[model samples]
Target chain A: MHEATLAANVLKIVSRAAAGKENRVARITVSVGELAGVMPAALIFAFNALKKETPLDRADLILIKEPVTACCDDCGTDYQPGPFPYHCPACGSRSFRITGGEEVRVKSMELKKEI
Target chain B: MCKTDHNHLEDIDLDCLVQEEDLRHSDRLKAAFRAAGVRGIGLLGSPGSGKTTLLEHLVPELMKKRRVAVIEGDLATDNDARRIQAAGAPAVELNTDGACHLDASMVETAFAELPEPKPELLLIENVGNLVCPVDFPVGEEIRLAVISAAEGEDKPLKYPAAVLRTEGVIITKTDLAPYVRVNPDKMVAYVRDMNPHSRVFLAHMDAAGKLVTEAADGGCSLEDWLLG
Candidate 1:
């Protein structure tokens, strides 16, 4: 499943970050976008499967689902996407550039330190 | 002097170590491409669209004129890579394990196992998927979206993202047109409605078993208008 691959990638990223810091990871924030084709339920399942034996096994994964929205670069109208549609809401113009919501990044972390 | 600077250093660290780590991985992939001297052409499509078969024929002809290397991505099995190797070129098999698509970092690792890029062309046969691959850029110069006549005419409309992003489209299994109920005109219209600029080709296996094409000059009318 695609979720497995995403889980592997998350472990690869998180494990390296956790090295030399703390024994436990308090929380990890991941940004997922609608257009990125990630299903949250599936991702959560994948997370559970992969994190079972890892150092950050008990870490909380905070997934932020970024909306699929774009703004009219010409008319400056903010638009929300409807069912994978990419055209601008008001103008029906595909020429409007995407402003935000296509991000897939691991933003920040809350660490648990040793005494 | 130190007492005056004790207001607090703000002590805020917004560093995302994963970002840098991922970049390093992508950079590794770029380095691999650089070493191969190969330009990548990504082939994307739905399952059973004859992408492997088309490449099975096209790669040999391309190799005759220039050195060609291929990177085959699939959810499982190295079947496509085996076929490419049989066709006579260096090939790398990337088993995504279960991933529906190939990302740049995977390519980087695949590149590591290959020889220096002496080839003039590199063909990246993406996982038999149209959706996820379009979102990830794998340092390719062109994306070739493959579709078979057996699938239906509404493919372009159904999966606009693949058609919209690709530089060209290949209509495969044209030799089976007599046996299938596909309408070439309707397919052309849908392609036009979604992506006005994408190039469409009717590719079939020749009697000599070579992949033959009629022309490459046609385009979607709306795409033509937009570009014009």
Candidate 2:
């Protein structure tokens, strides 16, 4: 999608947490789920381009990419789904719900000092 | 802020989503709609997917029973809003000015711009993009993507987020299906595979710009799903 806009949002989130350049951000770790529909490389590219001389300029972006997992509707077996044609492995049923890989969150941030 | 000495780095428990601000705006907009008794429906798709054309037909039909208003999102044109107005619905146009998607704050402001007494059903036509718009929700009770058969059947599989996030999928332009050799059933199957939760409908616009409901699940029409 528009990772530039999302990058700006990332800065907004980190900026608010950093209290406007007060905190020296060492690293910004975020969870980028596969099913969250965000490309990590694009997000990192935009983030780096935007973070230029800001407080977070030297901050390394650590992305925890989550795999797509689903739970069978009938059997409740959680499994990671592969390319299309997804179905429960145990029951062999197409009736499964996606349980993971849809989250895009900022889990924590590493700072030079305790905030 | 919890400073765990394991890494010698001060860690702060952010514990929040990247879309936190958008979700806040969306939650507020949703609460406002709830208080106003408005069922917000967002129609999204690529440009020329007949979103406005479908509204041109459905607006009048919906207004016959309840008050209906439309908010049109486009890059630089009020043409869609004007068309919706011609169809007898008070319309507001939101030009994103080259932005890919309409955020909740923009939609919240547009909702406030509609006519007084408030519409029972508010239709929001998002900017013509399949990827970004699905992620940026506009406080719609139901969101549906309009994919024309002219674009072929590969869209649902190519863009899984659109099918997964939206509650319904509408395939338009079935009249030109044979000409394009793109089977609409295959499109429906792919949509079902990606998201079995989506309600699928087949639609086509006539030469007069009238929307023809070519196929729909029994008693599960878009009208029934939204208005009910």
Candidate 3:
């Protein structure tokens, strides 16, 4: 699945960040948008499956799901439109643009520093 | 004293480190296209939603005006590529070989195979599944999603990501509405409700092969909305 590619990217990022550093990855936290089209479960499965034979094998994956939000263009109102029929509650305008919930990024990570 | 006890944990803020790199496959693909001066449109839809058929008509018409190249994404088959070629434009088929969607890396490889003189218009017909394709940006300047009347009016609601993310919606197979018992108006309304910023078009080719398309709220044809 496409999540495999995403997981691979995440591993690559973690590896590059830890390179030359005397540390071991303890955890990797990622934020997945509700509208990002990535299933968090699938990404975790892929991560676990592929993390083997890599430095990330010891890393624990933490997935945070971001909710979808939108801004009404006509009324300049911001609201959380969980899913479609995404109408602006303030003005009842169906015209709005997505403001969030479309990102898939590694937010942060916890590492164990070696003395 | 265990090694685990000797090591202390430190929190590191990645601040989107992966994204910070110019190394993202998708970003690299975008950069290549930008340097090559190639513009692309990504077409997303469900299978049998007339994506190939629509391209069959659109590629030739677009060829008359500007140089057009098509990158066909399918799970397996060069069939779509052949059709686009027959329509008078060079086409490259990128077989996913069972992958549900086409990613930017795939596009990067396909773009290399395109003939010289980088086409002014590059139409990447994404794999037919709407859900997976919505997540991947394959270096397209514009994104279009197609749904047919027979697919039902609730498609936009069911697959909000595909409908909401796209710049435009093309409701194909209008002529089959009566037989399929699908309400074209309701379908348009759902699409509008999901993403008001999207331009909705009701598209169908006449018996004479002339493309007839009407805007959901009326004003321009599909061609005007797409090329304009």
The most accurate candidate by lDDT is 2
Tens-digit lDDT string for candidate 3 (A1-115): 6788788889998888778767888899999888777888899999999999997799999999888889998999999985567778999887888998887889887878643
- Model 3 iRMSD vs. native: 2.1
Error of 3 at A30 (Å): 1.2
TM-score of chain B of each: 0.78, 0.94, 0.88
Ranking by DockQ: 2, 3, 1
lDDT of 3 by residue, B1-228 (tens): 123343477778785733343236667777777687777788999999999999888877777777889999998989999999999999999998898888887888898899997787889999989888877878887789999998987888888888878889999989889988988989988888878878898988799977777888776776655554
Residue B125 lDDT in candidate 2 = 94
| Candidate 3 clashes between residue pairs 3 or more apart in a chain or in different chains | none
Can you give the lDDT of residue B166 in candidate 1? 77
Which candidate gets the maximum TM-score versus the true structure?
2
- State the TM-score for model 2: 0.93
The DockQ of each candidate is 0.26, 0.68, 0.64
Please report, in order, the local distance difference test score of every candidate based on alpha carbons. 0.69, 0.85, 0.84
Clashes of each: 4, 0, 0
Query: Candidate 2 at B161: error in angstroms?
Result: 0.1
Q: Across residues B57-158, which tens digit of lDDT does each residue of candidate 1 receive?
A: 777777766677788899889888899899888889999887788888777667666666556677788898877777666767678788887888777777
Model 2 alpha-carbon miss at residue A76, Å: 2.2
